[model samples]
Target: MSLISILTPEIKKAVTLLFDANIDTIEFQATRREFEGDITMVVFPLLKVIKGNPVELGNKIGTYLVENVTEVQAYNVVSGFLNIVISADYYLDFFNDVKADKQFGMVEPNPDDKAVMVEYSSPNTNKPLHLGHVRNNLLGYSVAEIIKASGKKVYKTQIINDRGIHICKSMLAWQKFGNGETPESAGLKGDKIVGNYYVKFDQAYKGEISELIATGLSEDDAKKQAPLILEAQQMLLDWEAGKPEVISLWKTMNQWVYDGFATTYENMGVDFDSYYYESNTYLLGKEVVQMGLEKGIFEKDPDGSVWIDLTEDGLDRKIVLRSDGTAVYMTQDIGTAIQRVKDFPDVGGMVYTVGNEQDYHFKVLFLILKKLGFDWSTNLFHLSYGMVDLPSGKMKSREGTVVDADDLMNEMMQTAQTISEDLGKLDGYSEDEKTTLYRTIGLGALKYYILKVDPKKRILFNPEESVDFAGNTGPFIQYTYARIQSIIRKADFDFASKTFSAGEITLHEKEKELIKVLALYPEVIQNAAVNHSPALIANYTYDLVKEYNSFYQTVPILGSDDENAKMFRVQLSKKVGETIASAFKLLGISVPNRM
Candidate 1:
């Protein structure tokens, strides 16, 4: 039922006919915009082969396609471009096919296949989820769903960065200043509990460093002075040794962070199949390093550090193990990958949905994995999205400018509520109903904002500019869905029970365009899945809704007394509502029945 399978065959036939007619060197393409054409064949390349004027050649090809192609009702030639429009009857037939088949846009799976593992949102436990993590979660979830829709088995995982010097800082401060305070007692988020300590540590350490410098210690010496590092370092030692008190504190604090994160994930509508903790996996890196040394894949530096050579690959060499026998970040990733593969033996690919800042890191990891004789290492994919920047440049955590995930969601919801009230859309909504609508509108806005653009593109996040409710935004699409819902409710159309005349749809131009878009849902999912870009689905959904809205604005359905007119328009709206729901599902955005 995928549109591409049907249209690709049509494209190949058209290509064959063009070649047979002595037209050479032309490329056939399908476009979603500019023309109501299913396919656009750029014939400028064939102008030289035909030895004729470009426009005339285009006209010739257009005539030939319309005359010879049964799917094409007409073809328009503009500036050497031939736009072959499919028959309106064909679109109506496509709509009927989609309405009849539950798996209208989804393709049949290949009998044989490979598995894909996606790792995303590996947040540190010291802080609550933030906007950057939100982007990561949405991209990861969307990619997972899209891949599944494309008939691939996908494993979704996350590696919690639960152990490090940063964690020690939080532990140290909490031990010194927290005085038995707990999230339950303070009513603060688990991450916030740890994060308070992190901030306190910074404030205290900065002053302590300044005092040391005032006592004439050099900046470097004061910063890394023995006593200062001892407090933080002791926390790590306590954690490693599983000191009863430290272990109890760590367990309590980490559980709270996990609980808070679960709430955020629930709000965002994202889930993971497996969760990996660095507290456990950090030690795993050593085993991989030992194995690498045994296999002669890595050599020790003069300082007793294990290093991997990367100069030949046009990158600097990287450390795998430090002189003191401690594993580095890259080493932990290796162990994690190995563990994951063992967990899912048939996994053929590993997709790391981290930011672009780690592009070089993944490249080195993939190369090292390949050198270590892992064939599937070649399938390593880094879904590196760009950093979210503000009008004031990149967001920095140290400067307290990073947007917390919970706060951002609250602000978006509040904004959605204000807009809803201003528009008079939910005037009589009950408090509970209003709450539900707010969640839908707020989440839809947040998701659409993050996903409407290409992931790898650096997007400017302006509070005033980012969350537009009108053009190309989530609310617009949701509004279109709501309008369709209203239409269905008002008309009380029982499309599920009633049958319409197969070809009697008096399709309007806009209705035909909407149907064509609705027919592309499965194809869009497949493309987005392959590219690992949720933005594609987001954009497609927005476009679909926009067209549906245009059609709705132009055509009246329920009021029409004519059976064919009313039924056809109702059917079109039904298909649109169905298609939009599917697109929203792919983006991890939910549309309430009312909103």
Candidate 2:
């Protein structure tokens, strides 16, 4: 049992026995650094039921606890806080319980528990992914892993925007400018090649608009009359009509983008259980809108469009379908959501990993689902995150100012290489090993830097700052893990085969502190799961590493005066490394065995 579990009821019993007063709850926190206790119980909350001086009240409860519950070794009354020092046996017993258990801090999923579908990295097929997509993919993948760790069956999914004017812009531009250039011919990734055409289309459209404006046409009229845009729109219409040439072109280009996306996802270590394409699902929600209209959940505009009036719900009326009865993005999203539930019958909830700009959109969508009377609508969540900006400012995909995901990853690796070499640590590594380590450290640095902060806050990422070997970064935690691994390697004894008991060996304060931090791993995972924040896992691992480092510096592992103490400390270091690896696994980061 945890310290909290063992002590809560005991404290309640102590209060009743001593003060003849009943208490409903007990609040326990970690003892402050200046205090000489393991766990502190605030006496202020108990004061409501027992009328007395807090120090005296704490002393009475403390005295009762030490005499009765054996785990309470000692206590100190500091104003309202009753800091209780738990017995060394308690920490040792806890450590022994977990020492041999490899998967100590993770929960086993109940077979009867409902599954959760996490939707993320739903990139449009028109362009290659950018820095914003990097954050989305990392967050989504980490959250899925964390949810899985929290004992829920998780399915990772994405909705690809395959059919739209945006997609056709690339296609039309490719046909107009290319001399039958393929991705192979262009010597580029398919998405990168296609993305070039997308930018080309924009530049050409702007040039046409400028010419039209020079002819005395208003800016809006020039934009509407641009020949390039007109052709792209026509291509979209042709695609919708299932014209052979346009449909064939659309399929070809979309396949290129998918191939490119697969490579990127593989490199970035994100995966999807299923994919939903807009071409197939665009018309899905039209029927749902009709169903909503018949059920009075939605209203029809005079132009034969579908809308849900959410003004009474504190949102404006949003269109579901166009006047011509074509499905809008909202309509497609509705159908996509319902389709997921049908696809995964066991799913009881869904998390949409989208940007904060669409916060209102999800609110309105969830409300509409609830109004449409889906039982699982209440379980829906929007894991909305803010944008990632560079020091240079915002990124625009069409303008080509955006930081490409693949390029940024390479840059991160290069940065890792530069910093690692400057540190002069790779003494005997092979070329392949050095290269692999650089990529691992680079990616780890990138992921940990972004994930260490709250998801709702925008990040101004600095590659140099993130790759540092010290402080609250990925390399820091990873280096600590590596250090533990080195200790385990040098121990010369079979530490894994032996288990240490809580004998007459005296406990070091550093050892107790390290175990205490280790004990919080499971609680941290649960908290991260509840809040849908990988930041918790990232930071919790940092704290664990910090504590372990303090223990390392202050105490001896292999050279301890006592043989059993030395072996136990070595085992403790091994377990700490395992826990760090487990936590980093939840954040989709890899730890190096050497630094």
Candidate 3:
């Protein structure tokens, strides 16, 4: 049980006995640094039910805890704060019990509980995955893992936007650009080749608009009348109508993009449990719209368009079906959500990991589902996050100015290599080992740099700063893990086989502090899962590393002459390393044994 769980009822008993009153809850905080205690209880809140000075109440509770609680070694009151020092045995016992469990912080999913589905990286096939997609994938993947670690069954999914006018533009551009070129012939990944055509389509369409404008046509007229754009629009109609030739080309091109995406996902260390396609799901919500209309959840205009008026709920009217009887994006999303629950019957909740630009769209989507009388809609969450910008500024995919995900991964690896060589820490390593280490450090820097920030905040990512060996960077933490590994290697004795009695050794102040931080891992994982924030786990690992390093510098481990103390310190260091590895695994980042 947690210290809070164990102390709460006892403290309540003390309050009832001393003041003849009852209290429902206890307020606890980390003991202040200047205070000589491990945990603190705020005595001020008890004033609501009892009449007494805060300090006097605190002293009475402190005396009670010291007399009645075995874990309470001593206590002091600083104004309204009752700081309690826990026994050294409590810290030692906790370390010994959890030291050997590889999955110490993670909980196994209970079969009886409902599962959660997380959607992320729902990229359009018209372009390659870029920096924005990078953030989306990392956030979604990490959140899914964290939820699973918190004991829920999690499913990771993404809906590939394979059909749209934007896709038709790329197809038309490829068809018109002369002799047909395949991915093999173009010496490019399928997605990159397809993305090139997307950019080409935009360039050609712009050139046509400029020419028409020069001939005195209005810019808006030129844009609508651009021959290339007109052809692309017709192509979308043809694809929708199931023209054999258009369908064949669409299948071929989308397959290429899928093949390229598979490679990118593998390199990025993210995966999906299932996939959805927009082409199959786009027309799904029409029947649902009819059901909503019959149920009075929706209204139809005289023009025969359908909408849901959410003005009372602080939102405007949102169209589900147009006057032309075509479904909007919102309609597709509604159907997709329902379809997923059908696919995974046990799913009780879903988290949509999309950028903040569509915050209002999700609001309407979830509210509409609730109005439609879906029970699971109450569990829906939109994991809305801000955009990631480079120091160079915002990116436009059509203009070919976006930071490509694959290219960025390569740059990170290169950055890692440069920094690793400069640090002169690669002695006795083979070329292949160096390559693997560089990738580990590079990707670690990338994932940690992005995940370390709160999901709702915009990130200005700097590659050079992220790879630094000091400060709160990934390499720094990885280096600390590696340092622990080295200490373990030099121990010469079997630290794992030796067990020290909790009463046999008095813990050092640093050792006690380290154990306190270690005790927080389980709670950290649970909190990260609850808040849907990987930033919690990321920062917690950083803090643990900081605490371990402080303990390392102040205490003797393998160097200590006292064998019992030395063995205990080495065992503590090993546990810290294992915890680091386990935490990084949740973030989809790998750590090296030697760095």
Candidate 4:
């Protein structure tokens, strides 16, 4: 049981016995560095019910705890705080209990609990995955893992935007550009080649717009009359009509993009349990719109566009379908959400991992779902995150200035290799081993750097800083894990097989601090899951590593003369290593045994 769980009821009882007051809640925080206590309780809240001086009240509660609770060694009243020093035996007992359990912080999912489906990396098929997609994937994937660790069954999913005018543009560009070139023929990943055509489409479409503008057309009219765009629009119509040639080309190009996306997903260390395609789902909400119209949830204009007015709910009217009987993005999203719950009947909630630019969109979507009477609407969460900017500037996909995901990952690996070589820590490693370690350190740095920040805050990512071996960087935590592994390897005795008695050796201050932090892992995981944030887990792991490093430097493990003390320290070190690995796993980062 956690310290809070143990002390809450006891503290309530103390309040009742001493002041005849019944309190329902207790607020506890970590003891300040100068305070001689493990946990500090706020005595001011008790003032609301019991009228007395705060310090005197704190002393009374402290005396009660000391007399009734064996774990309470001593207490000091500082202002309105009751700082209680717990016995060394409590921490030692905690360490001993959890030392042998490898999966100490992870909880098993309850079979009766509802599952969650997380959607992320929902990239359009017209372009390859980019740096923005990287953030979405990492956040979504890490959130899913954290939720799973907190004991919920999670399904990772994405919606591929495969059918649209944008997709038609890429197809038309590919068709217009000379000798038919396939991914194999172009010697490029399928997505890369398709992305090149997307750029090409933009180039030709711009030239046509310029010509039209020179003929005295307004810019907007020029853009609309651009021959390339007109052709792309016709191509989209052909695709929708199932024209044999257009359908074949669409299938072929989409397959190429899919194959390319698979490779990138594998390299980037993200996966999905299921995928929804826009082509298959775009027409799904039309019947629902008709049903909404009949039920008066949605209103139709004279032009026949379907919409839901949410002005009274503090949002504007949202269009679900166009006057041309075509579904809007909102319609598709609505349909996709319902389809997922139908596909996975156990899914009671969903998390949409999209950029913050669509924050209002999700608000409208959720409200619409709720108004449409779906019971699961309340569980829908928008994991809206801020944009990631480079030191250079923001990226533009149409102009082809966006950082590609594959290229960024490769650059990270190269940066890791360069930094590791300069550090001179791989003297005895083989070539293949060095390569793998570089990738591990590189990807670890990238993921940790991004995941360490709160999702709502914009990131100014600097790759060089992320790979550093000091500070709160990934390599710093990873190096600590590796150091612990080295110590475990050097220990001559089997610490795992040993157990310590209650009074075998008194705990060091650093040892107690380490155990306290270790005890917080489960709570941290649950908190991270509840908030839908990976920054919590990332920072908590860093804290644990920092505490372990402090303990390592101040205390001797293998070098200790006392057998029991040395065994206990080594076992503690091993558990710390296991926890670092476990926590890193949730963040989709790999901790190397050596770095």
Q: Highest TM-score, which number?
A: 3
lDDT of each: 0.80, 0.92, 0.95, 0.93
User: Global lDDT for candidate 2?
Assistant: 0.92
In order of appearance, the predictions have TM-scores of: 0.91, 0.97, 0.99, 0.98
Using lDDT, give the best candidate's number: 3
Off by over 4 Å in 3: none
lDDT by residue (407-427, candidate 1, tens digit) is 888988888888778878776
What does candidate 3 score on TM? 0.99
Output the better candidate (1/3) by lDDT.
3
Model 3 Cα lDDT, one tens digit per residue, 63-146 = 999999999999999999999999998888888889988899999999999999999999999889999999999999999999
Sort the candidates on lDDT, descending order: 3, 4, 2, 1
The C-alpha stretches of model 4 lying farther than 4 A from their native spots are none
Worst 10 residues of 1 by lDDT: 1-10
Query: Candidate 4: minimum summed lDDT over ten consecutive residues — where?
Result: 495-504
lDDT of 2 at 526: 87
| Tens digits of lDDT, candidate 4, 1-595 | 7889888999999889889999989999999989899999998999899999999999988998889888899999999999999988889888889998978989899999999999999999999999999999999999999999999999999999999999998999999993699999889999998899999999998998899999999999999989898888999889988999999999999999999999999998999999999989998888888889999999999998989999999999989999999999899888889999999999999999999999999999999899889999999999999999999998988889999999999999999999999989999899999999999999999999999999999999999999999999999999999999999889877788877867678888899999999999999999999999999999999999999988999988898888888988989999999999999999999999987
Ranking by TM-score: 3, 4, 2, 1
